[model samples]
Target chain A: MDKRKDAGSWNRHKIQAVWALLTNSYLIGFAQGRIYKGSLKNLCLPGLSCYSCPGAVGSCPIGAMQAVIGSWNFKFPFYVAGFLLFAGALMGRFVCGYLCPFGLFQDLLHKIPFPKKIKTFPADALLRKLKYVILAVFVVLLPMVVVDILGQGAPYFCKLICPAGTLEGGLPLVLLNESMRSAIGWLYVWKNALLLLTIVASVLIYRPFCKYICPLGAVYSAFNSVAVFRYQLDQEACIGCGACAASCEMQVDLIKHINSPECIRCGACKRACPVGAIHFRQAGKSRQSNTTGL
Target chain B: MKRQLQSSKAGILLALAGLLMAGVGMHRGEMSTVFEKAVKICMECIGIG
Candidate 1:
């Protein structure tokens, strides 16, 4: 009945689901506005679903929030904010692990048969601060402050750096639409090239963007401590083998705190624990006695 | 069997939500002539108008 024995099946199912969601061209087409009025609309999803995707049925909360706050007549977007908070509270970074189409894309790119693996440098404390700075400046304050002053606001992250927007929204549509191809300028080519480079780098690096960047990850991480469906470490059972930390791609020191914000609950640590020292339960689940495993 | 049933129910609920949203988006014009309002809502939601 140990969950670790069946961990392979769980990981496989999660990976398969990710592929299904990402490669569903019909869904992509719907999001891109091809099936609709040929205008970009918002989806109410918590993650960054590109409004430009033809198959997207709801608005991306991140994009929607930016558009609302950047508007000349500023009014609070209660629906979008409420939806994001609700989703974040319920699932935490489980959304990052399983639901995000963009995250799925990054995972696939990381699966390429590369000779080397990029390990995290935990000693480099400055590198860890980058995502928080990005979240505070680019994701939150900049959009509200700079865009309001300029009288025109853009999805700054998407326009400048987000390889996700290029991969999920731009490249596919441009290939399909002839007019779009003609309208493509130097900027479009530059963005596409950046996306291509990231894809190639991901093979060598384990989620470079998620580790060092990704404002959304920064936000979701803050809630990981209290999120429902959290990981619990049986301290007495832990032999301090460090196997969990060794296997962790997210670079979490699970023995210290399995529910650390950096821990994506990817269950790598749970599976890696030789002594079955780790288990997952809902946040409010009664704490059980911690018994050491032989 | 019970676990399988619960998973199936969860899957169904997610699928239904996705379908309902897609349907509503498709008939957006019929639902509301609130393009400007929707844009405004989206702008505030995203912090870029």
Candidate 2:
């Protein structure tokens, strides 16, 4: 097979793995009478899979962070913080590219037939900053300072904003269990509405939430420079055509900075590179042929 | 053979983690207990329930 075809097949496999992780609701039944109390609680998966999801086998780091921040007894979740650091160091925002169920959902939505595509604008530069502000205020500081002091803690972002929680955890349980539906109120209605709006927006736009919001993406992005999986650029390669930048929806100028925070390691830039300059390097291993220069 | 072994190991580890999380999440009285605690906390904070 041609090298390009081989790369495409590998990408397809990765995409399939992502799909399985996202839609593993049936695994909930296997969890019945199986799990125990004392287990590994720290340094979990990078994506925002809800711990409350019946099929979820690991702790949701965001949920864990909220719980720790909300708790009056605990000072802060050093364990979760360390975990995010570890995950970010290992994979960078590849979690956003290959792991996040919500990201997959958005990608699927974008595949729908839409006349006009949501083009990136100069205002997006300012809007992207909103996610970091949210991470600092809502995800980190609010629960720790305000809620904990008041002896109340809630996953504020998940409650008010996260359509992932509604779509992945809320909708499934409600559909399966009638009791949950009866308990639903205005908040549930609001979350469901938000999910609907996000779905519609995702179809029209290219991952608007991942681009603008999502504190997790913000966290992973900060570690892009020093991550284990690093993107290398061959400066020796001739021809500085602007093809890679044009192909990259993330808007990263690959020639200038291969490790830009905006880069999710989606390989689109690599695929667009004509001179085979951009590539993914894992540790000190031999550089393998990837999607670069397709 | 080495690659196959590595793949199997990964599968086993994931399965074990899944079992452990589910078990802790759904022990006879504990599941409802955790949910109640989480909901009560959410209700007081958000003023919903």
Candidate 3:
């Protein structure tokens, strides 16, 4: 489906734009090469904005989780976990759809009017499970288990994998801070390569990182089936037109897998339906006519 | 029908539990811990120290 024809896409982009700005509002910090030191950083943002970013005012949940787990105390990250659970239970990967800065970055990139856009591939299903593995190892296990002699575990995902940190944090900081420039090494080169690869992939495909690498997406996806606010198909109204499937950038089979974990609940399917069969059904509330406010 | 009911209950319960745990974590000063990390530029973590 042409994104221009999908009615829900416009509202989603507006929300994503506003949310990205609100989460990264420390404009002066970017100029000065310093992060926001305000108390607001204590609250975890649902999206994957790197806290190290000069303009970031809130902490990234995934980064905060690794920090809490890898701290000298080595405590389980109850706060971050609780935040994820609350957000996931409330709306599942809707956060990814409407809030994630990296997601928005990819969305904007994928809209660059490339000649060919590969929606899905043969290894898509198998490759989709890679994020779960990364979540288990890089995000959760390595931080909790692998420690230096001093018992401090590094944020392995941030250092080694996350392109957001590279683009948002490392690049700006190094460029702005002369003292930090001398410290650049092989790791910086490595991260830049990954960031470039991600950028190219984003232009050619829709949300490759979200589909294949994001740990936060992995966690939220686990709650998709049980999320209180979710998409539902009205069997009586659906005309087997397959418009929903055609509209989904994530390529979710909106009929057979209405509750699939792969769904980001972007509401493209809802707007694409000729019969208006799709609706956002909040528990105990009546069915919604449109995707507004969702 | 039964499964959706169960999932609804589970989701509600988990939300409640999250509320409780977050409150406890805040009381225990985990919020400050997050603030501490977020405030500083970690050179080694992002590999730009």
As for candidate 3, its clashing pairs are B43-B49
Provide the TM-score for each candidate, comma-separated.
0.74, 0.77, 0.95
Residue pairs whose backbone atoms clash in candidate 2: A34-B23, A35-B23, A35-B24, A36-B24
lDDT of 2 by residue, B1-49 (tens): 3433343344344334444544543432333333333332232122123
Model 1 stretches with alpha carbons more than 4 Å out: A1-43, A75-77, A121-125, A148-152, A286-294, B1-49
| Stronger candidate by lDDT (1 vs 2) | 2
Q: What share of the true interface contacts does each candidate keep?
A: 0.01, 0.01, 0.61
- What TM-score should be assigned to candidate 2? 0.77
- lDDT string, candidate 3, A1-294, tens digits: 355454457778888999999999999988898889888998999999999999999999999988888888747888888898998988789888998999999988998998989988899989999999999999889988999898878888998999999988998999999888988999999998999999999999999999999999999999888888777778898999998899889999989988688898888877778887877766644376554425
Which portions of model 3 show Cα errors greater than 4 Å?
A1-7, A289-293, B1-6
TM-score of model 2 (first chain only):
0.87
Worst 10 residues of 1 chain A by lDDT: A285-294
Query: Residue B48 in candidate 3 has what lDDT?
Result: 69
Candidate 2 chain B: minimum summed lDDT over ten consecutive residues — where? B39-48
Candidate order (lDDT): 3, 2, 1
Which has the higher DockQ value, candidate number 1 or candidate number 3? 3
Better of 2 and 3 by DockQ: 3
Best by DockQ: 3
Q: Can you rank all candidates by DockQ, best first? A: 3, 1, 2
Write down the lDDT of every candidate, Cα atoms only: 0.58, 0.64, 0.86
Number of colliding residue pairs in model 2: 4
